[model samples]
Target: MAPLMLFVVSMAQFIDIMNGSSMTVALVDISKALGFDSYSTQWIISAYVVTFGGFLLLSGRIGDMYGHRKVFLLGQIWFGLWSLVISFSTTPAMFCITRALQGIGASMSVPTALGLITTTFPAGPKRTRALSVFGGFGAAGAVVGLLLAGAFISSVGWEWIFRFSSIFSFLLFVVGYVAIPVIPAKAVTQKIDVAGAMTATSSMICIIYYISTGSASGWASVQTLPVLIAGLVLLAAFFWIETRLVKNPIMPFRIWRLRNFSSAFVAILFLQGQFQGFTYFTTLIFQNVMGYTSMQTALAFLAHSLFAVVTFTILGKVLPKYRLKPFILTGFGFRCVAALMFAFVQKSTSYWTLPFLGLLVHVIGLGTSVLPAQITALKDAQNEDQGVVGALYSTGMQLGAPLGLVIVTLISENSVDVKMGETPVEEVMKSYRNGLFGVVALGVLGAVITAFMMPNTVPAPPAAASAPTTAPVENSTDVATVATVGAAAAVVDLELDEALAEAAEKMEMV
Candidate 1:
């Protein structure tokens, strides 16, 4: 039962990562089918990410307030339905709409899934192993998506990706209903913080939308600056409301006080941004510049993916007994090496020099950072807050991809345009160099954030044979609030259940 539940949780997480990577391969084909230019088609990818990242906090909070199982199932059903819509989308606008819906579903599902894993296992070796497998599967899914996308696009059609995801999502939904244990609410009737949720969601949407459209529409265009300004303003407003307005704000400012958690979040943001940015541009370099086929590109990524899985598995077994900070530090060092190699990649550089060696260094770095960071955050989060905190961690990751894409694309777009003249290979390489430099700068900043902010040794969750463990919670005040909310929520749930039962009886009579 424990293993089955773990698989269900990991599978849901896999779907989220797979959706992003798979869609990336299908981007070219989808553009041709939907009659979109390069600029317009980018939205199909960006829109999903924007919505997914924006809603993560709210979705995770919902799981914390209500029940992880309830929210997870709801997210799955909605995602499956939206996937069906996407498979048959006739226009870019329709595709974008359904894509956003799919993001919403993913947002709902991911945090709750992570929370469920944490809730089901105590914060010792069991939880550590589970999280390791979870992280490994996530990396593995991206690799699988790349391979599957290539094969499906070549043999079947781009539409099959959507169809496959839709089927897989539904099957998971069904499996979840049967297997996932219902986690009782840790808090009573928690009043929904409608105002805070709306403000944060709207702010994120506006900021991301502005970034997504700004380059194509002209950064100075009438629509861009105002939207960007508004988003920042609203985000500021959200911070204020969370701090002052709500009794139980969605993302309590208190969580940030933990030096380890706060630093991890920041480093991951930069780390994820670079990670996502690398995949996008590298794929372009291989397929567009070097004229490598999708299958070849997918094959290239496999080595990195395999290495990541191996590292995660090893980390899972060892982290429970050892300190994680050193591993994190070492990880960042590897990332720096990888970023430098990629930054100076020559147009004529063979696979052995730039692509293969650079990626090997990168994957090693990525595994080191992620395994330690995820363990650090969840290991300390209170039992109740695990769902939302897990969600926030993932939001940092998902946000990085689109945010990185927008930033790097803006920087590199001007240099890579085709014209009526002879553009040298060196010029193409120059644009890539610019993007890689951006990645390297971010990586250096990430290393600094991790080294200074994270502690030398964080207290681990008490092992079975060691001292008695208190529930992992950095903030006592937040824990008190979660309890109060959980208490209030039970009454409302009973009332809701009764009302639904009555309504069902009435419908049967009719």
Candidate 2:
């Protein structure tokens, strides 16, 4: 039953993540069919990203309060319905609007899916294994999305992408309603932090919008700079509200105090940024420079998906035996090496050579790093806090995509002197290589943070033998002594109750 339920949940994650990357190959086809200009075409992707990233925190909290399973079902129905609408879209505006709504649906499901896993499985090896499988499905989804998009575009049409998604989403919703256990919401009486939710969501939307569009629109232009500053201001105000005013904040600040939490957060951010940047540029180089068709480009990434699947499966069995630090550092090391290799790609280079090898190495690094980072972040969370904690981790990933693209786009643009018209292949190659070096820099930064900040090993629970036992109470003095001991025991128990609640309260109040 657990395995079956995991499949349903993991499949949901896979489908949601697939939408993020599937558009990479399908975008050109979509642009042609919908008559979208270059600038407006970008909105097809950005609309989804903006809504998805912006709504994640609020959705996660909603799941925690309203029952994860219920929210999960609703999200699936919403996603499926919008996917159907997208397939029928005749205009660019309709497609982009549906895509944005689809993102909101995804935002609702992803964090809750994670919340369900963390709360369903007890912490330790069982939960670790579950997470590894869940993460593996998510990682595979990106590459599979590309592969399927190419196949669909080459054969039927791009509309089939959304049509297929709609079918799968509806199937998952039906299967999930039966397979997933109905866990009750947390019993806390506090209302949702409406003000905090607004500020946080608005800040994310503004920041991500700026990051996604700033390169196309000048960074200091009226459109980008003001939004960036407004986002920062809203972010600051959100923190102030969370720290000072909100009795129950949408995002509690205490989760940051968990062991290795901050380090894992930063590391995953870098990892995701590099991943998005590398894949985006690689796809462009394949089609624009090397002149591969969409199908050919998808086939080129087959190695990456295959290797990631294998590595993740193996890691699920072996990850419990080792410490996280070594895997994290080694993963980053592989990423740096792969990006460095990609930096030298030439127009005449064979797909079987540098690009192929780089794909293999990059996926290996991703498998090695991402799963452990997820475990590190979620392992210490209290069951009640799992939804929001997972949301924070996922939000880092969502933001990283646009942030990574922005940085690499700037690097590539600045590196070459190509004109607005058709440019030579050699100049384009040079630009891509320079952009890849930026990815290498990101990998190096992740490695440095992992080396210095992440602890060598996860803290283990105290052995049962070390637990204090109470003797029979005999008299008044002994009863008093027992009371004192009981009070101490209760404190210890609270600390051991995932160590997130009372500690978070103390830290926030201070």
Candidate 3:
């Protein structure tokens, strides 16, 4: 039963991730088919990214108010329906709209699915193993997706990509209904915080949309400036909703108080940021300076992709024996070292030298860094909060990555005419190096935060060796669990308990 549930959850994640990778690989072909230019084609991807990041918090909170199973099933149905619709899209507008809806569905499913996993597995090796396969799919599935999309586009057609997703999604939907438990709505504690959710989701969409457009349209764009300012205003409104005005906040302020979680969030933010910068600069080196073919550029990343899968597989088993701090600390060190090495790369550097070695080192850091940070952030997580935590985990990546890439793009934009074959290799090398130096600094900062703020010790095992197979058991320990956080978060979570405690204190005072 547990295995079946795991299968459902993992496959849900696999399909969601594959959607992005497959789209990226087939972008050029799709553009030609849909009559899209370089500028217009971007909307196909950006629409999906913005909507996914934007609605995560709201969706996650919705799961908290409703049962995760209901929400998860609804999202799956939504994703599956859109995947079929996408195949019929003949125009660019039609294609982009369908893609955006698909992304929203994917976002809705992921956090709720994560919530299900947290409830299914106890916090020990069982849970660790479950999460490993779940998280590992994200990295390995991307590479696999590229290979599959290329194969399908050449042999069958681009529409087959969505066709395949729809077929698989239906199968998943059937098995999920049978295997996953249904929690009654009466089990829910709080009503939906609609005001808080709306403001936050709108603000995030506005911010990510601004960044996505600004990167392409130039930072000084007059149209882009209005979006940026509007996003900032919405952000201020969101903060006001959460901290000052709301009686029941969508995001409780005290979730930010977990030292380990906060530290992990910061570290991963920098890690993702630098990784994006490194990928952009590396792609330029291969295609622009070294003049590799598109196929060759894709192939260069294959090794790192494989390395990530194998490394994560090993770490899943190895992590139970040691503290996460060592792995996180070591991983960030590797990240800094690789970025620093890449900063010194010359125009004519060999494929097997520092460039190749640096890719290896960087993936090592990435594989190691990602999982431990996830483990640390989700540590001491309560059952109900799982959806929100998972959403936050992903949001850091979606938002942090854009910020990193934009900064690097700005630093490296020196009018190097590689597309027209007019620029000097010497100029290209200078631009690449400058971009990489910024990444090196990002890596270093991540390492420092992990060292100072994150927990150094491995967590103690679950209070009992086993939680019941049918229902999740709550932890009773005093390791800064939900009650402690809720007491600080708002007047809502512990109202009954808090009122009693206060009354008891008053009787003793008399």
Candidate 4:
């Protein structure tokens, strides 16, 4: 594969993964800079997340209708534009809105880029190399983002983070414009399910809005309650519409018939919620209560980031030799233990204690989780739904972050007295400890879901992906090199699921 195509397709994933973590260390800076109160400030992260989650399904459908390359280029351009605007943002509203727009661009770029990769590479060793490159980068982007963001936020400025992203995005835009070939759309015509998509997106936005600001609004204010109820109504309507009204839905009901698939989806959804919630608040704990600088907080997280790389590197080698069950279960079990360990952070806690130990263990879990989960989520999915399932898997991962952050925000800092400046660090620490206990519970639940729900054996890669090639060889990028240089899967993202029941006619027919 040409380096330019690899860069174009994988860059967006890198940016998205990087953005998610890059902001965490800088979040305290953002809050103080913009004069945002705790409740309103949550939007800095949740705004991007709400849009990222809401817009994912619609964006993929857009790719199917328009040319994937065109949509991808447009998306990258949009992201570059938004990143530039974000660096110049002078107010909280400006920052939040621009970040949301950035998420929209990201939503547009990712699936289309993957589609471009698939269409660009023939379905043999070439496609495998492309996918291995693609997935490897997708997994690694978050840690790279964290490292750079941490180093630069203090050395340069948090604003430099966006400036760098803007520059990289534009460079990719130019390169992609010149190099990314236009691929013709397939003959399959799929409906966009406009109504269901809108309802679902709107419902999620409203619900997240309610969770975020509802705490500061007194949780049941007349204005907030109505929005919350309306979100529920819209959510109910979305299900009804998808199940009965739409000729073809954004999420096909038939896909849920695979028990493993369904179980994987729920497990991922919960795991992500826990993971992001943990990251957001833990970032706060390290910087705020622990009195660490942005640089220090970033450095503290360095262990998790480094170990994630090592674990993935080992998995790439060992996965082919091992049944996924041992790796998958052990990874999830480590995650559960890590969460439980993190729940023990204290006001006087040493960095090397539960905080460091737990983070180290958690990264190992993340490394093991991503590949098997990706393999599992797409396990029995037909080739036609590959794009959609991949999109769904990505969505399942992206959507969890904001909701988890919201729940943590509410539980840890919701008291009106705290806003009134009557709260002490001791009392605040009490709330933080309690809130983290809930996080530990979520992690345990996710592990439980996987242990009992996902298949106990390794699933074979899909036939289109794994079958031997008799087709004439084309010179390709060295996959072993790519695997050796494999990337990181975030504790906060890339949560895929495990395998399902035997591929019988009932589920495969779709």
Candidate 5:
């Protein structure tokens, strides 16, 4: 019951993460409706990611100091209020500010939700299942966000994305109030690391803003160079401060010493960059070059979500019984292949040949990599450390997408004009493909890093004869026997529970 409760709460957080990307589908609409030029329009996307990534560590630490549930609710309340502001936005500046606020809300929700899951669920089959569902739904919502955005953009208007998100926020607030239990009281004793938090946040904002704006102003221009330099310098200062001064830093310097953990974090960064690149490039190709309608573009991505869910379900069920390393390897290998294949996709190609096949393979490969990696990344981490673990992993994801977007935008802009019809579709797509190839190269590098760094075996079982372990082992064995003997009784009890949970999720999804 407790694990199930945590799983649902995490899913709500996934929905918030998904909402951040809905604007991609509405980018064209937003450009037209808000009268944004090419340069300003990108901010409509970049600002959200920048704020989300910037404050993530602080939000996680805040949740660690205060209660996770309290922080989560606070984020929802702020997000719901700002989402309404987004819906009513009449100018690009207004939209950007609101989106930035939405990003803050998201940062609060996502890491805290994962912290809740890690703290609440004991490591075992039950937790594994819940995590599989968590990873699965997050991937699914990203795909669904595009579809929903397309549908809303065309059927009603682009503003509906914000409207729907606002409504969803309200609903989640209500549901969380009734369904989610508070985190155990002892977990909230850590003090907030104010200097580390502020330095990190400000430094990250400076860097991300520099990169996001660099395309409009040349990288060498005065406007871009100062911000980039300041950001780099301040970020260095952040690390120095964290290591030397802070008693409890938001990102503890010690965790990076574990090769597997650092490797896993890098892997997530590369994979997420690859994922966002694929989705962004493909969607642009379909809509901008191929002249596909919003509905068509949205529907095109349906296969990605479906294939990811299917692969996740199969992989999740089997990984528990075997060493996790082989699955992780296979997933990365598949991901590299899929990403490389996607890099070769052409604007003139048939939808059935490269695009569909590439997306399917990528989705399946991503599914295999993510769930196991997420588990391995935080394996055996104490409850006190879960906030850092979640923050670290999710920071990889949030930072990766914007970084990828910045890279792709620079590549595509330098080589081809997507906004200009004078540029050939093939040439534009070629530039996009060039950017994707770089992302794929990063994935291949991540795979190699993971191969060497991640432990190559299952976790070792506790010693059976240890004096401290004896009583817990005996009780656990007894519990296992009782569970097996009472399997028939538990099966009936669990069936109703599953049905109810599904119904609840469906209601929330609506």
Candidate 6:
């Protein structure tokens, strides 16, 4: 039952991730079918990203206050319905809007799924192994999405992408209903932080909108700059509300005090930024520069998918034995090397050469680093706060994808000084190489920050003997009573000091 539950949740993750990656491959076909320009086509992806990233924090907190299982089921239903709606889209607006609505569902589902894992699995090796499997499926989903999207597009049509997602989502909902155990809410009395939710969600939407459009619209243009500043201001306001206004904040400020959690958040942000950007450019280079069919482009990523699965499987066994720092560093190191190799890629480069090798190394980095980060982030979290903590970590990833894409797009566009369709093959290659260098720079930054900020080791769990037990006392003699009282007093003092220290540390971190 436990393994089946894990499978259901993991497949939910896989389906969500696969939806986005598959859409990437189908974008051109969709654009042509809908009679939209390239500029408008980008909104298809952006719409999903904005709503997903924006709502994640609130959704996570909702899962914590309500029940994860209930929220997960709701999200699954919402996602399936929206996916079905998207399949019938006749215009870009219809597609984008339905996609955005679908993202709301993803926002609800993902963090809650993580919450379920944290609550169900006891911390330490069992939890670590569960997280690794979850992360592995997610990693595999990205590549598999590409593979299936190509096949779907080539054979039937791009519309089937959403149709399939809808079918899978509904099926998942049915299976999940039976498999997932109902965990009760930690605090049913806690009120939703409406002010914080509004501020945070709006700020994220603004910031993401700016990032999504800045390259195309001009960074300083009215459509981009004002929204960017507004987003920042709202973000500042959200922090203020969280710290002062909200009694039960959507994202509690205290969570930032956990050094590993904070570091993991930053690490995942940079890691995802590089991954999204790298994948974007590589896909373009394959289809546009090398003139490969969509199916071929998808096949090119097969090696990456295989390597990621194998790496995660191995890491699941190895992680419990070693500290995570080395793996994190090694993961970033792999990314740096892969990006550098890609930066030198020629138009004529063979699939079996640099492309294959780079994919292999890049997947290794993803497998090595991401699972460890997920484990590290959850390690210090109290069971009740798991949903929000996971949400925050995922929010970083959501934001990072668009941020990375914008940075690379801006860099590449400026480097070549020519529009994509109009550029010569040599210039296009040069632009892509320049964009990869940006990924290399991001990798270096992530590695350096992670090395310094991430703790070398997490504190060990308390021993079972030290844990408080509720069994009635067998004896109530005076000497035994006194001994019990003294021990309880000492424990109380120790707990108070620990709590105070944690409070002070959280303040300092903030």
Q: What would the TM-scores of all predictions be?
A: 0.87, 0.89, 0.85, 0.79, 0.85, 0.89
- Point out the higher-scoring one by lDDT: 4 or 6: 6
Error of 1 at 484 (Å): 18
State the lDDT of candidate 4 residue by residue for 1-510, as single tens digits: 356887778877787778777877678788888787876777887788778777776776666455666878888889889988998888999999999999888888887776666555544344544554565566567666667887886677788888888888888889888888654454555667889889977887777667656656767898589988999999999999998888877766666776556666766776677777767667767865677777787778777766765666566555654555466667667776776676667668899988999898877776566556655565554433445566677777775655565666667665323532466656666666666766766666667777787776543334655543332211123333333444433322343322234345448887
lDDT of 4 at 173: 88
Q: List lDDT for all candidates, in order.
A: 0.79, 0.85, 0.78, 0.69, 0.75, 0.86
Over 1-510, each residue of candidate 3 has an lDDT whose tens digit, in order, gives 778998898889888877777775688889999999877887877888899999998888777667788888888999999999999999999998998898888888888888888778877777777777777777766656665676778778889989888888888999999999775455326667887888888888888888877878767688678877887888898898788877778887667888777888887788788877887777667766677655566676677678877877887888766788888878878887787777777757787888788878987887778888887877766766777877887788888888888877777774333333555777777778778877877777778877888878665465433634445532233234545654676666578788999999999999
Query: Stretches of candidate 2 above 4 Å error?
Result: 185-189, 419-421, 459-510
lDDT of 5 at 314: 76
Considering summed lDDT, which 10 consecutive residues are worst modelled in model 5? 465-474
Error of 3 at 446 (Å): 1.9
Candidate 4 lowest-lDDT run of ten = 469-478
Give the Å shift of residue 432 in candidate 5. 3.4
- Candidate 1: where is the Cα deviation over 4 Å? 185-187, 343-353, 410-422, 459-510
Model 6: residues with Cα > 4 Å off, grouped in runs: 185-188, 419-422, 458-510
The order by descending TM-score is 6, 2, 1, 3, 5, 4
Q: By descending lDDT, how would the candidates be arranged?
A: 6, 2, 1, 3, 5, 4
lDDT of 6 by residue, 1-510 (tens): 678889888998999999999988998899999988967877878889999998999899888778788999999999999999999999888988999999999999999999988877766666778889999999999999999999999999988898999999999899999998765334325679999989999998898888888877889998789999999999999999989876778887888999989999999988999999889888888877788999999999998888888988888878876889888889988987888877777778888888899999898889888889889998888766889998999999987888888787778878887676787988888888899889888888999999999999943353422444332221124337757887999999999999999999999999
Residue 154 in model 1: lDDT: 90
lDDT (tens digit, per residue) of candidate 5 on 1-510: 465566556667657756866777788889899899977887888888788888888888777667677888788888888988999999989989888988898888888777777666556554566678778878888888888998987788878888888888878788777666754455235667778888899888887778667877768789879988988988998999988887778887767776566767877776777677767777877776667888898888888878877877776676666666677777767766776776676656778887788888887778778778887777755555667678778888877766666665566667655655777777777777777666666667767877887777564232311212111111134457655856977788899899999999999999
lDDT of 2 by residue, 109-210 (tens): 899999888767656666777888998998889899999999999999999899888999999999998998765344444589999999999999999889
Error of 4 at 298 (Å): 1.0
Q: Candidate 5 — what's its lDDT?
A: 0.75
